[model samples]
Target: MEQHYITVPISRDNPQDVFTVNTKYRVIRRVGSGAYGTVCSAFDQQHQRFCAIKKMHRVFEKELVTKRCIREMKLLQLFSNHPRIIQLFDMDIVYGLDEVYLIFGCMDASLHDVIHSQQPLDTVHAQWFIYQTLSGLKYIHSANVVHRDLKPANILVNKDCDIRICDFGMARAFSQTNSMPYLTEYVTTRWYRAPEIMINSHNYSKAIDIWSAGCVFGEILGRKVLFQGRDHVDQLYKILGVLGLPNDISFWDPSEAVSAHIKNLCTTDGLPPPTEPVDFNAFFPSATPEAIELLKRLLHLDPAKRITAEEALKHPFVQPFSDSVEESLVPPYVDPQQYYIFEDVHNNSALKSMAIQEIEFFKHRMSQQELSESLLTNNTDGTITTAKRSHTAAVATTMRHFDSSSSWQL
Candidate 1:
C-alpha cells in the first residue's frame, strides 16, 4: 500500500525513535516511549491542534500485545465523552503493516514530569490533582472496570492544573457478581501497587486504584516517591515498614496461599518486626491536617478500609473543588460487554481484523458526529433548506446505528 506519510527520524541522537504518520500530522518531536509503544507530538494541520501520536511496535508479535492494543482502543472509544479521560481523536492502520497508530489530544506534561521538575506545588495543586484522579476513577469503577495501573506517569497534566488519565492497556472490566474473577498479578509499577496485589491476594477490587492515588498524593506533597522500593520484596517491606504489618491478615481477607506466602516472607526474608508507622503530621509538616487525614485513609493497608473514590471526593481536603454535578457517571445505556469484544479471541489474525474494524467504527462515528453537529449549527443559523432537512433525517438514521448491537464482529 502507498503510505500517506513519510517515515521521519525523531531525533539525530535517537535514530530508533522514528515515526510514520499521516501527512496531515506534522511530526514535531517524540514525547514518551515504553515497552508497548512510542508516542510523538505532532501538529495536525487539518484540526489546527497538537496531538500525541502513538505507534504500537510489532503489534502482532504476541497475542497478548495484540489484545492489549485492541482493548485500549475500545476502552478509549467507550469513554470518549468523558472529560477526565484522555480522548482518542483518530487512528490508522495499513493492511500489510505490523504497526497501529493512535492519535490523542496533546497535553502539556505528565504528572511524573511535574513531580520531578523543580516547579513548586502547593496544597491547592495537590488537592485539585487528586480530586481529578478520583473523579475519573469513580466513573471507571461505576462501569465495573478496574484501571489496575495508576501512577504518576500515566496521568497527563497541564499548566492550568487540569489532568486526564491515560493508558488503559492494563484495564479490565469485572462481572457484576459480588466476587471478582482471578486476574493477572503483574500490574501497576511496584512502588504504587496495592498491598493486596503484592501479597498475591485472591480477589482485588478498585481499591487498588485508591492506594495508588494515595501514593501519588504523598509524592506530590513530599516532592518524591513515598515508598521508593528497589525490588518486589523490598517494595512489600517498605510498605509494611511505613504502614506496619496488618494486626491480622483476615482484616483484608487474604487467601490461605497468600497468607502463607506473607508469613514465609516475614520469617525467612529477614524482614524487621512490625513497628509503629511514621507520623503523617511530622512526615508532611507543611501539609494541612485535612490533607494528611485524607492521605492516611487512602493508604490504608486493608482494601476494605481504604477510602472509596466517591468518599475521597467529599473529603475535607478536596471538598472545595468537588462538584456533584460535574462528577459524571458512564451513561446507563452503554453495555460493558462492548469493551470486552476481543477478550475471548486468542487468534492473532482475528485480533488484527477486529482492531481494523475498531478503527473503521471510530472513523465512521466521528464523521457521523461531525455531520450531526454541522446540521445542528446550520439549523440554529436559519440556513437549513428542504434538502438539508432530508440530509438531517439521513444523519439521524446513521446515528441510530451506533447502539449496543452495532458492535463490530468477525
Candidate 2:
C-alpha cells in the first residue's frame, strides 16, 4: 500500500499559517458553515479528487450536540455505500485534540440551493429527484434508520441530477415493528415536519420522513415550499388547510394530543368541531394526477396512512425510474444505542472525556495497517488488499466478520 500525505508550504517564521492534513487532503477554501461546524472544499491527493471537510465546532460544549455528531458519523458510515446517501471519505481526529473534522465527497449543490435559485424543474426532473429520495429512504428504512430531518437543505445533488441525502445528525434506528419508542421531543424542521410531530404525538414512525420527502417533492414541483408556516402551530394549520381535517383521530392519538391543538385554534369554545376537508386537486391544480396522488399519500395527516418509501417508489410517477433505484450495499446492523456518546445535555468534564473516547474509537476503526512482505512473498495464492473508503465500511465489515451481535466492540 502507498502512504499518502498532503504537504503545506510555509515560511520558517510562519509555519502555523499554512493549512495541511496528514498528507492525504489539502484544504482549498471555506465553503459553508452549519450547526456542527465549518465546511471546506479540499483536494484529495490520494484519490486525485475534490472533497468536503467539516471541522466540527464546540463538539463537547453540549452533550446533545456531541451525541448528535457522533450519531451522524456512525449513521453516515453505516449507509456509506448507498447511492443516494452522502459518502464519508475520512474522519480526522487527532489525539488530545478537542475538535474533529469529517471529510466527505464534494457535491455540486444542494436541493435547497436549487429550490431557492428559482430554477424551474420540468416534470421529468421533479419525478427523477423524488424517485431518488424514495429509493434512498427505502434503504435507510430497511436499516431502521429514520432521517428525522429530510428537507431540501439536507439533500445534495450533482450535475447529473443525482441526489444524496445528508445531515444524519438527527437520524435514529428504531424497531421496525409497531413497538417504536416514544420520541415526543421536536426533531425535524418546522415546515417539513410531519403532522404527527407537529402535534407532539409520541407514536412517530418512519412515515414522518415520508412526509418531509413529500414536502421536498412538492417544493421541486411548485418551485417554492408547499406549506410555508411561521411557527409549529401555523405549520400544522397550513397542513390541515391543504389536506383538510381527518375524520378519525384514533390513529393519531385517542387522548386528544393532535385534536387538542385543532380545538384550541379552530373553535371559539375549546371543543372539537367537524371541519370540511379540502380537495387535493384544488391545491395541486398544476400537478399531474399521478403526482397529486403521490403527494397526497405522502402528506397524509395520519402517519399510519402515509405512504411508505417502498410504496411511494411503486407509485406511477416514480415507478418509471425503478431501473435507477438500485439496491444499496447496506452493512450489517450495529445498534447505535451501544455507542451512546453522551449522557445528557451538559458541559461536564466527564462528558468531554467520553466524547473524546468516542472519536478515538472512530479513528482506530478507520486507520489501516501496513502488511509485511515476508508474510506474503512466498504465497502462491493470488490475493489483493484494498483500502477501505471510510470508517463505517471498515467497522461494518469488521463487525459482520467477527460478530453480528448487538454489542459491538473494536
Candidate 3:
C-alpha cells in the first residue's frame, strides 16, 4: 500500500480523474452508508494502495457535508501519524461534491465478530485488546478529543494480535472544560452507554468514553455485551443494576463546573447509593483479576473519579505490552479497527472502489502461497492448517458450524 501524505482538492471541473479506472481504480462495489455520505473501498491504480473513499452525496446541504468533511479532516489531522487511530491522507472536492479518502492499515478480522461468533476468548487476549484500546483513548483524550461512539463494530484485529480503534465521525474535542451534547454526544451504541448519559445527566465528561471502553472490554471476555439494553433508560438500568445503583454523590453536583443539567434531570425522589465497590469477577467469573480491576476503574459512576486514559494505559494489563503493541503507535500503519466493518462496505461506494484492490491482493497472495477460499481439509498432523496456509492467524472462532473449538472462526 502507498504511504503518501497529501492535502489537495479536486475541482468541480476536473473531469473526475480518479473515479473513472477504466476510471482509474476499477470500481469494486459499495461498502456501507451513514447519514450523509457513502464509503467505497477503491484501488488507486496510480497510488497502488487500498483506499476507502468518502464521496459526499446531495442528501444533506453541500455546506453541511463540506463542514463535516472539514471536521473529519481536522480531527484526522489532530491525530496525524497516530498508528492506533485511523490515518487521514487526503480530503478533496470531487465532481462538484466534497470527497475525502482516509487511509487505514489492513486487518484479518475484528474483535467483535470473533466474540459475537460465540467463541470464548481468553482473558489474556481480552486484556491485551482492551489495553491497546485504552492506549489509543489515552492518546486521543490527551489531545482533548472524545470518541463519541465505542462499539464492537469499531474494533478490529490484525495478524499479530494487535488491536486498533477506529471511526471519528461522531468524535468531539474540547480545549477547555465544557458540558454535553458534546460536539458529538451520541457516544456509543445503546448497550455500551454510560450511566450519567443514560440518566440524562447533561453534564458529561471523558469518563463516559472510558465507560464505553470498559463495556467493549467486557464484550471481549464475556463473548457478548454485558449490558445489552434497548433504550437509554434500559441501558442505564442495566449498568446500574449490574454495577448497582448510585447515591446522590454519584450524580452531578451544582457546586462543580457543570450547568444546572443534573438538578434539572434528577427528580426529588432520591435513591440510595452504594458505597462498596461492585464485585465484577462474580459476574465475569472467567476474567482475570487484572481485567476486573481495570473494569472497575473504568465504570466508576462518578465522572471525576473514573480512570483517565493515560492512567489506564499505565495499568498492568496494558502496560506490559505498551512498548511493543502496534496499535499503541499511530500513523504510518493501518488501524485494524477501521477495516473491521465486516464487509459492510461503507455505503457501497467503498466496496465498489476496493474490488480491484481485493482482486489484486488476492492474486498476489495466490501467486505467493497458492491460497484458496477453501476451509480445512484432511491433514497429516490432524490440523489442516498445519499442512498448508500455516501462516493464517487463528482466533477463538465458532463461526463454522463444526469448529466449535476454534476461538477465532467467528
Candidate 4:
C-alpha cells in the first residue's frame, strides 16, 4: 500500500512532548493534553484549513485505554454525518510506537473557555448554545449512545456561535435488551453527574446526559459552575443544596442499599440536608423565567422525572430558535450492539489488531471522500454535472476552509 502520511519533525518546548505526525499537517501549537492523548492545532495543507490533531501515545500500555481509543474512533465514524457532532476527518497509527492519531474538525474554543473569558453572553447566546447541545444529544440518544461525559470542556464553539460536541472517549453504546449491563459510576465529571449516578445506580438511562446538559446550561447562565464539589460526598451535597432533598425518597427509586447510604450521609455527620430548594429567580436573577423553568426540568434530582433532550428542545426557552422541521428529522442510527464486539477481546495483541483494522477502514473512507471532492473541483461543465454534484455533496463537506483574511486567533 502507498503511504498516505509521513512523519514530520517540529520544534517543541518540552522534549518529552515531541511527536511525529503526517506531513499533510503542519503543527501550529499544542492546545491541550490529558492522561490518554495530546491535542494540537494544525494546518491541513491538503484540505487548506485548520484541524485538531489528537495523538494518543502508548495506547497499548493498558487494555482499558486501548479499548477507549478504538471506541472513540468507531463512534466518531458512526456520527460523521451529524453537523453538530464533531466530525472525524482522518486517522493513522505509528508503525512501531503503538501510538494513534485522530484528526477532527477544528473549532475556536471550548464552552469552558468562553464561560471563563471576558466575553459576555446574552440570553440569545445561552438559548442557541443549549439548543445546539440538546440537538446533538437528541441525535446521539436516538442511536442509543450515551455521551457519559458532557461537561462544558467537551463542547467546542466558534465565533459564529456554532456548537460541536466532542470528546466521546468515555461514551458507551447501550444494548437494545431490556436488561442493561452494569455501568461504572465514574463516567461523568462529579459536578455534572446525575444524582442517580452519584448514588451508584446500577442501571442508569440516557437521562444522565440530560442532567449534564442541565449543568452546562446553568453554568452558561450563571457564568460559573452550578455545582462545585470538593469530593463525591461534597458533590452530592452541592446538588442537594440547590435542588433540596426529594419530598419522597421512593420517587427516585434508589436501591435499598443506596437508600440507606443516602440516609447515612444526611444523618451521620453534623451536616443537615437542605430543607428547601434554592429560589431559581434569586440564584440566577439575570435568567428569564423561561430559562429558569428549562433549567429546573433539566436539573431534576430524579432521572425519571428529568426532561429528555427531545422534549427539552421543545421547551419555551429555546423554542424560538428550534426548527420544528429539523427537530422532527432523524439521523442514521447505528445499532449499539455493533460495539460489543470489542468487549470479548482481552489481550493487548487482540486489541491492537482491532485498532489497525479500524484505522484502515477510516483511511479508505477518507480517500473516497477526497476523490469525490477532487472530481467536483476538477469538473469543467457546471450545468452538466448537476447530478454528480448532488451525489458527492454529502461526502464533499469538509472542514470550513479558511482564507488569508480569516482570523485564527480565539
lDDT of each: 0.80, 0.71, 0.57, 0.80
What would the per-residue lDDT of candidate 2 be over residues 1-410, giving only the tens digit for each residue?
A: 34454535333576553334567777776666776676778888867999987777666666666767777777887787788899988776544445667888898778887766634566677777898888899888887778899999888877656779999887877754745452533588888988777665666879889999999988887778988988877777677766667666666667666566565565335433336656656766677889988988888777877899988888998765675425453456555444343423356577666656665666666553223443555435666564433223432342212122212110
Candidate 4 has its poorest 10 consecutive residues by lDDT at 387-396
Displacement of residue 87 (Cα, Å) in model 1 is 1.5
Question: What is the model-wide C-alpha lDDT for candidate 2?
Answer: 0.71
Question: lDDT per residue, candidate 3, 1-410, as tens digits?
Answer: 33333323233465343332124443444454567555556566755766556555541244334334434544665564555666554443333332444444444446676777655456556756787788778777665567778777776665555566666766765544553233323456778777767554566767878988888888776777888877675555456556754436435554543323332332235543233545677778998788788888888877889998878877877655554333343343433234323223334344333432433443355445433435436577765553221111332341122233545532
Instruction: Indicate the TM-score of model 2.
Output: 0.78
* Order of the predicted models by TM-score, top scorer first: 4, 1, 2, 3
User: Candidate 2, residue 302: CA error in Å?
Assistant: 0.9
Model 3: residue 22 alpha-carbon error in angstroms: 9.6
The model with the greatest TM-score is 4
lDDT score of model 1? 0.80
| lDDT, candidate 4, 169-232, per-residue tens | 8887776653455254258988888888766566478999999999999999999999998888
Q: Between prediction 1 and prediction 4, which has the larger TM-score? A: 4
Deviation in angstroms for 226 in model 1? 1.1
